[model samples]
Target: MRITNNMMTTASVRNINKNMERLSKAQEQVSTQSKIQQPSDDPVVASRAIRYRSYVARVEQYQKNVDNVTSWQEVTDSALSDLSDVMQQLKELVVQGSSDTLSDSDLAAIKEDVTQLQQTAIDTLNTSYGGRYVFGGYATDEEPYSMDADNNVLFKGQLISDFNDNGDEQAIKANIGYGTSVTVNVEGQDVTGMGSGNLFDTFAKVLDGLDSGDVSELSDTLDAIESNTDTILAAQADLGARMNYVSMVGKRLDNDYTTYKELMSNNEDVDMAEASAESATASTVYEASLSVGVKVMSKSLLDYLA
Candidate 1:
């Protein structure tokens, strides 16, 4: 085949274009600090980077869930602690009211204290966190317990069995990991005697017993108050366990997030030093290609004719 000037010029232009492309890619990597600016740059690396990024995002979300769970559990624990203190105070009042030496006026004063204690317990039961009732089961938007005009405690939340379609009275849960979740609440019935009966019924009865000077009934209320105190204690224990689980999961998620970030860096981020070196080399080669193309194009018969 005969060599032609047109063919030579075309070939030189193609080589210059190829060299410029390499140089451009190297410059992009150095400037952006990324191995691939587009998926087409390196499909395999880009795919792996995508997966690693997804994992990192998921770990971040799980950490957020763990944080939310911790907040809810902390609020629940604090409220339960308050309820426990109230129960203990009520128990003390019950014991004092049972004494036969107390006068009518003294009994009336004790009843007043009992009423205050009952109201305190009610407030504790209606505790809210982040604008949602912590003890309302899945019906978190509503108060779990309230007092009517007659001072009777009313249940305003879902039943334990009605919390979910599975009929399990599980509290609100947070997804902390793969196939893992933590319950972050204690239902009203579990702690405040909302479903079984009024936790403060014995408090009211003790008030009545004091009004009539009935020592026997006041003495009996001591046992009922003890039972309610035990219930609150049990709920606190459960909340503590859930809190522990959430803390452990949070730690694991932290470690996972660190690992995911490292993996993503390895997959997608460019080594600055190496990319700089490559960019320098590509620049030198591209300039040499331009020089060679210019030298070839200048050696033309038309130049001699001019």
Candidate 2:
């Protein structure tokens, strides 16, 4: 086989160009800190990277949802605690008011205190966080309670509670005994189970009893009030349990976040140590190719004849 000088030179230049290209690619991989710089580098890795990016994005969105729900849950928990405190104080005042030794002035003072407690409870029911009502469920933009002309309380919100998980309408149970959509907004008309009197109606009667200086009429009503407090405590206990469950879920979410991040790193993030080793190996191969090309090109047809 006869080899020409032009062909030999062209082949040597091509080999050097190929080596330079491989070296440039290695440098780019190091600079970018990515093994799969382009789809041609490793199509499977590139596809995996795309899928990983989507998974990370979805995990981030889930974290955001968890943040919003957990924050609102905190507000609801605080409101429930405040309501319990107010109920406790009101119970004490009712006890004092129940005493036969109490005078008209004493009864009036207790009524005033009870009114304040009722107002506080109303305020708690209407509690808002970031302009959204905590206990108002999906009707977060609206107030949950309102006062009538007779100074009696009326619940304006629906009994439907909506607690979603991860933006899906997964009705996470907030109460054990109560259904997920339990109507918590007990209207004056619907109160039952503690004898015929409702909370709002019974409380109104208590006010009248105070005005007429009739303390004895409140005995049965006080019993009903105790029962009402028990109901409130039951609901609160349920809320507390829900809060705890959410907290546990939040902890698990954090763990999941960590696990996903690590998995993503393994999937997409470059291993610097391995990349450096590859770059070094490429450098050696490229340098060896250049040396071989120089040697081959330096030997011409005229030199062979000599």
Candidate 3:
């Protein structure tokens, strides 16, 4: 090999460029706080980072669903609690109205109170959360119960049996974890007995019985009111169970999110201490390479020949 000045200059320049590239890479890692800015930097790490990020995203969505489920269940539980209180008040009114010595004016006042309590029960059954009826089943847009011109309680929403034919009473479910779901709604019929002559009808009957001083009908309504109170308690229990399940799932999701985030950081995040050391070393090497290249390239062919 002649070992010409031209060849020496070319080789030195190439070496300097290689050193600059290494320095640039180190600087990028330190500046961005990332090991692999692009997939080409480290394909395996990049792929794993992608997967970990996707897992974290999914966990986040599950957390949101769990939150929504919790909110719905809380609303349902509150409504049931209110209904229980209303039923208790109605029971007291029924007992007073059943007395034999009550006058026509006294019976009228009792009827008025019963009517108000019935409306309260309807309002409780038609409770809404986030602008959607909690007991409307799938018909979240409409009220679950309403009173007719004849003071009869009607089921405005779909019943469980009606779900087969475009019914809105289907249970509301949420995905709280991988391949796991929980129902967050209590159907109106289940809570209010809307399907089998309803709690509201019982209230109306009590009101009419009180108005006419019909002690027999009022006594029967008292029994029916007790049954309705039991139904509300049952629905509250179901909501409580669902809420517990949601809470458990939420805790697991939080832990999973933490794990996924740690994995993602390991796959793509740069170690600041290591990156800083490497960047400093690369900078020194690049500077040395540039000095060497300048010295080599400044020498002419004549000087080499001499």
Q: What TM-score does candidate 3 get on C-alpha atoms?
A: 0.90
lDDT of 2 by residue, 227-302 (tens): 7667666766765675676566557657766876777677656788877787898889888878888888788668
Q: How accurate is candidate 1 locally (lDDT)?
A: 0.84
lDDT values for all models? 0.84, 0.65, 0.85
Off by over 4 Å in 1: 1-8, 98-103, 157-170, 194-198, 300-306
Best candidate (score: TM-score): 3
Give candidate 2 regions above 4 Å deviation.
Answer: 157-198, 287-306
TM of each candidate vs. truth:
0.85, 0.78, 0.90
Instruction: Please give, for residues 1-306, the per-residue lDDT of candidate 3 as tens digits.
Output: 688778988999898999999999999999999998789988999889889999999999999998988988898898899999999999999899889999999999988888898888888888899999998778899986776676666676333223233454488888889999999899877887644546776776787798678999889887788888898898888788889889999999999999999999988889999999999999999999999989998887588589
Q: TM-score rank, highest first?
A: 3, 1, 2
Q: How many backbone clashes are present in model 2?
A: 0
Q: Find the 10 residues in a row with the least total lDDT in model 1.
A: 157-166
What C-alpha lDDT does candidate 3 achieve relative to the native structure? Answer: 0.85
lDDT of model 1 at position 253: 90
Error of 2 at 261 (Å): 2.8
Q: By summed lDDT, which 10 consecutive residues of candidate 2 come out lowest?
A: 184-193
lDDT of 2: 0.65
